[model samples]
Target chain A: MYKIESKEVSLYYGDHLALKNISLQMKANTVTALIGPSGCGKSTYLRLLNRMNDLIENVKIEGTVLIDNKDIYARGIKIDDLRKKVGMVFQKPNPFPKTIFENVAYGLRVNGISNKSYIEERVIRSLQNSALWEEVKDKLNKSAFELSGGQQQRLCIARALAIEPSIILMDEPASALDPISTAKIEELIYELKDKYTIVIVTHNMQQAARVSDRTAFFYIGELIEYNDTKEIFTNPQNQRTQNYITGRFG
Target chain B: MKKIFSRLLNHLITVLLYISGSITSLIVILIVFFLFSEGIGLFGKKPTEDGFIMAVNKSNTVNHLNAEQIKLLFDGEITNWSEFGGKNDSIILFRMDNITDYFTEEQIGENFENLPACISKVVDSIPGIVAFVGKHYIDKNFAGKELQVDKITVGDFMFGKLWFPTAHPVAVFGALPLLLGTFWVSIFAILFALPLGLATAIYIAEVAHPTVRNILKPVIELLAGIPSVVYGFFGLVVVVPFIQNAFNLPVGETAFAGSIILGIMALPTIITISEDAIRTTPRSMKEASLALGANHWQTIFRVILPYSSSGITAGAILGIGRAIGETMAVLMVTGNAAVIPHTLLAPVRTIPATIAAELGEASQGGLHYQSLFILGCVLFIITMIVNLAVEFISRRNRRVAS
Candidate 1:
């Protein structure tokens, strides 16, 4: 089933064109990696999925972004509820100052879920799915800041998962972490494909190659290539994609 | 040679700075030493039995009377000079003011034996009156006039409801109510200022934009630089009447008025310090909370406020110190009444105000004068406790933060 689709979408920050016309479809139970150099609109495109750009004043966008065949930016749509369904992990681990358990339970609390047992179960399950349960279960009540960088990143993932979002967006999630933590994140992304549709933005070509079934390459705010990961990496139709894959120039 | 000369010049500058600093410190230490030397003398055990005594000077007249004859004359028992079998004369009442330049300690004869001789002569010469004499002069006799009384009673000394220090039994001040009133007014001033000041700080720190903050911050800080007497005048004219009319009271010069004025005056110090602290909260922490879906208010309450609480508390303590040490504003608005104020609406007196009002008229070594020194000691102790508390709490907070 189609989880999210954007058609002829363009994004602008005031007078500057941040994203050119683009069309894309994301399927359920699949991981799509969006790869580009810095300032090439990958993060902006990812933010568009949940309307994170709405936070910026004077941001303008054309065309429609649909989730499950429903236009997300349609009149009467609530941004809070949209955010509840579309979870996002930022470039850096941004955990609240609260304890790990409370951080995981924040979305649920905001949504007015008060059942302690259910919240506890969800929190544990999310941490387990994020592969952070064993490492942090002993110190769940400690402040999230007490954790290492990698542990904090996993804790943030667990926080997103605790809310049971169907579409998970990862924007350079492993960029701020070490190699071992990056591999762990890659493995977790592979594991999450069965339960959630995932879109990841990355500058690491190897990370994209290892974790995603399909890859989309962007350059200068325009989609340069979109195809199967193997095809795009091994036999690209575009000369820019080949140059980028072969490490000629960004 | 040039380098050596420049080095010598630098050394000279450093030496001069060091010497100046040392001299300043020495002057402060010497002033404290002097106050202690003069003040503690009153507490030392004197050989005389009485706390203080007064007698009439006998150099001006000859009165061949025994101690009983003089005692009877001063008791309002004998009204005329004939009671002492003297000429038919009305008893001459010789007080210190009526005496010669002896009060100024001018050289007398060949011996400057009695300083303040006029004070001594007034004490020794009265036939139908009483006067003041120093404790050191009790044994010195000139022309057969002797010091009459030993100790002044505590009741007659203080709260005789009268304050005539030149009288036979001078009023010794018992400062129970005045001390209590001082504490009450200071505490109320702190109470009035703390919340409003802290709230203003938070708004300036967290909520205001840069332009608004820049404008408001200096305005508030400028409030501190305004002369305190101006605040006193404003309080007397505006706050006093406002409080009076609001409460429908007979007069507006009450402790509440004093506290309100002091509280307003203290706001700049408290708000400036606390706002600076709040503004220093790390932007990373704020972003972290915001990214976790907490709004501005929640982030402020949960993160920024807790981190800045120590600074806010320090500012409050500073404001308390300011309020306790305030003189003019409180004196003008507090009605300067040395009574135990039972309610906020009643008139009150604080230590600084009492000292300012009473010190000029108080005789140098009288009990009332000493009482003001004791009040000074009390103010010093109160400020010391507040400083110590701020230090202790700030240390504890630093430990927890680390």
Candidate 2:
């Protein structure tokens, strides 16, 4: 059974259609990568999984987005609960202007967790999972801004992980990072799929091939192809996907 | 020809911008120098050896005097007249009345203008004695002997306890309470304005839709441009009555009332600066919070408010400086009483208001006159401190942002 599914979903920004009749399924505990050029509705489609599009004004979404067989857009669905289940990391690292410990513990604190032992344990576990604990454990009380860019990105990932979401959404999460930082994030993504269903939107084809289990190609707001990452990279399926991957055209 | 025209235009623009920037600094320096030099004159020592102490009245008449035969008449000494050659007359002392012109007809009397007539009247009314009065009140209609006028030595004036420096014993202008009152009122005004103003800024910057923000932002900004006198009038008419009625007081003029009005006046500055700061918080921060399952209130409080805290603090200090420096509005609403504030509801006098109310009629070189200048200097120092604090906070905020 699929962990998350989107059926015939379309989205609009006022009168302009942004996504047209998208459909896909993501399996549990696997990494799925969405690759597309800018403004191809790839990010827009990923945002719908957690109802993040609700924050934008005049954004009209159609059809249903389901997670764990529950319609996330249904009337009784709480945005906060949906977001908790599906955590998101942005392209740029945005650690809170707080201590390293507080940055990772922010979500827990916001959820009204008062037990210090529980928060401390969860923060350590999350940091260890994101592979940033060793480098920053000594400076947990230092401001998050004190960390370098690469460490800040990892800290953001640790912050998201501390919430214990079943699914992690990465919206071009490594795009703004340097080569070394990007490699570290890709490695972290590969490790993350063991415990969380991951959906990443990336323009880097090599990164998608390296880290993702399944790959979906989007063009002009339409889903061009979705298949196993190996198959998509090796076999002839869609001309547009081939062209985008082969560097002929975007 | 074209090259020359453009060059000429460039030079003209540069000159205009430079003049605009330098005008305020130059004027401020001149004003400070003027106040300092003139204020320092109150402490100038006189060379004259002969001296006699004289008492004056509100009528501007000189009626009694200490004979020049005496070595000296120090301040707080000679409370009675028998010591000064008068027949056991209690020396009636008159204050400067916080009026700017010590020699003004309203301050002295509508009828009397010189010391001699005042002395004649004093002698006729109080029997035989000597008194020092305003120079404007001097004439030969009085019967009492005119004592020699004692020049106010600089040393005596500075250390003098009382502020009666008119024509005889130069009054010492006490600045301790007036300065304290100013600080208290301004501090209270900032305390009142900071939170309310920042909340309004957050609502406009982060929460309001375009339409609501457009409508409310200008209205708040317009408050900063309103003439302070108009605010004073509003405080006088509306706020004073409201406070008086609500508090069951005899009058409405009070420190609390002044703080409220000044707070309202300062709202535009605080809101504008803080809103700009909140607006400039990186959008990525907002996205980060939202992605963490944090609710709108949580994100606003945790991220937006903390990020903009320094700017909000800057706005608050600027607002406080404005409140402390305000003159007309405070004078109208604060009851202009130069006493230390015991409660928010009590009437209070701020430094700027005290200076404004008293500088108009105070003697040009008298202690009362120079003390007002000193008050101006105090205000200048306070505003400079506030600006410096703002700079420090801004630099720290910039470092954090980077």
Candidate 3:
């Protein structure tokens, strides 16, 4: 069974159709990268998995979104519970105006895990998983704003991991950071796929080639192609995908 | 040539602007100088021409008595002339009135027609006689000598508990009661307004539907635009009667009535400022909280409210400044009793109300007039401090946000 599936999903913002009928599935413990040019509905497709699109006004979704073979869009499903099982990081590093330790520990506290030792352990382990533990362990009480832009993004990743969700969604998570920080995040994503099903949206074609095992290219609200990263990069089955990857045309 | 003309015009405009700005600054400086110069004069000793003079029989050894001795002697607390290095004779007090224990209206004639003659006769007949009369009533040819009075002191003006601005011997300038009343009403007004204003702000900013917010915002702003006297009239007609009927008091006007009116007046300011603060929180921050599996209420309390805490505090301080400087509504509803109120139900007078009520009746260049200016100075300082506090808090919030 697939770990996550979107069966013929379509979405609309007011009268403007943002995403067309799209079907995709991901196996357990695999990294999937969605790549496209700007306003191509790649980020919108990623947001559909965790229902983050619900926060926007005039949003309409049609079709089934399932995780662990259960329909997330079905009635009687709690949105908060669905969100707890699928953690998301934004394009920008938006940390709460709080200390670094508190930023990481917020998810656990909100989930009603009151044990002090458990929260402390989870925060530290999540920091270590994001490779930010050694740099921040000595000053966890300092404000999250004191960190550089790259460190703040990694801290946000650590915040997502503290909840221990089975699926993690990243929307251009490293697009705002420098090259060195982008490589660090790519390396961290490579390690994270061993335990969590990771889906990342990227604008950089090279980034999708470096970090993803499977790749899907979307164009004008339609999924143009999906295949193994090596196959899509080496041998193209679609003309548009070839044109995009070769930097000929978006 | 046109370019040169435009440049010359620009220079002339600059000069005009400078002159206008300097004129405004100069006027402000001159007002401050005038207010301080006149206000500070209240603390010094100056002989006022309108006070009562104490006259003796000329044989009495006491030539001058201090303010306290005069007060005590007139209050009937001192009955023996021997207390002041005089002959050990029984003291006979004389006052300008229709009837007294020492003399009757018949003996002094109807309407006290021969008041000056009667006073001269009384002083010449009794060696220990001490008479109190207006300075204009004292006859210079009589066999009595006028005793010199001492000047009023700053300590007496500030700390004296009584507030009778038209009292005999001297008009008391004691300001403790008015100051306390101002603070008392303002504190109660804040206590009444803060919770209501903050809740309305949160609802409008976070919980209300868009259509509801659009309607509610303008209605609240309309509350601010209503004239203060209209509020005073509402307080007098509605709130005053309601309080009196509910508590069964003899009079309808009380400090509680004033607090209710001022609280209503301050709500718009508090609500508008706090709502703006809450709405300015970045959308991404809110999304981050919600996406972390936190509910909307949790996100508001944990993230939105904490981020906007300084703005809310500034709003509250500004509300308090509005309540403290309010005059006409307080003057109309607080019963205008110049006494230190011991309870919310008691009649009281605030400083602004006192200045507004009595400044008209106060004689120009007199002690009462100068004291009113001093009250204005106190109000200016209080408002300035509150505004500075608001500036400090908002600046600190900006730094933290950055």
State the weakest 10-residue window (summed lDDT) of model 1 chain B.
B156-165
Q: Candidate 3's residue-wise lDDT over B304-391, tens digit each? A: 9888999999999999999999999999999999888899999999989999999999988788888888888878788889999999
| Reference-based TM-score of each model | 0.70, 0.83, 0.86
What number of clashing residue pairs does each candidate have, in the order they appear? Answer: 11, 32, 0
Could you say which candidate leads in DockQ? 3
Q: What local lDDT score does residue A116 receive in model 3, on the 0 to 100 scale?
A: 96
lDDT of each: 0.77, 0.80, 0.88
**DockQ list for all candidates:** 0.14, 0.64, 0.65
Q: Which stretches of candidate 2 lie over 4 Å from their true place?
A: B15-25, B43-170
TM-score of chain B in each prediction: 0.70, 0.70, 0.80
Better of 1 and 2 by DockQ: 2
Clashing residue pairs found in predicted model 3: none
**Between the candidate structures 2 and 3, which one is better when assessed by lDDT?**
3
What is model 3's DockQ versus the real complex? 0.65
Superposed model 3: Cα runs more than 4 Å off = B1-20, B46-160
User: What is the DockQ ranking, best to worst?
Assistant: 3, 2, 1
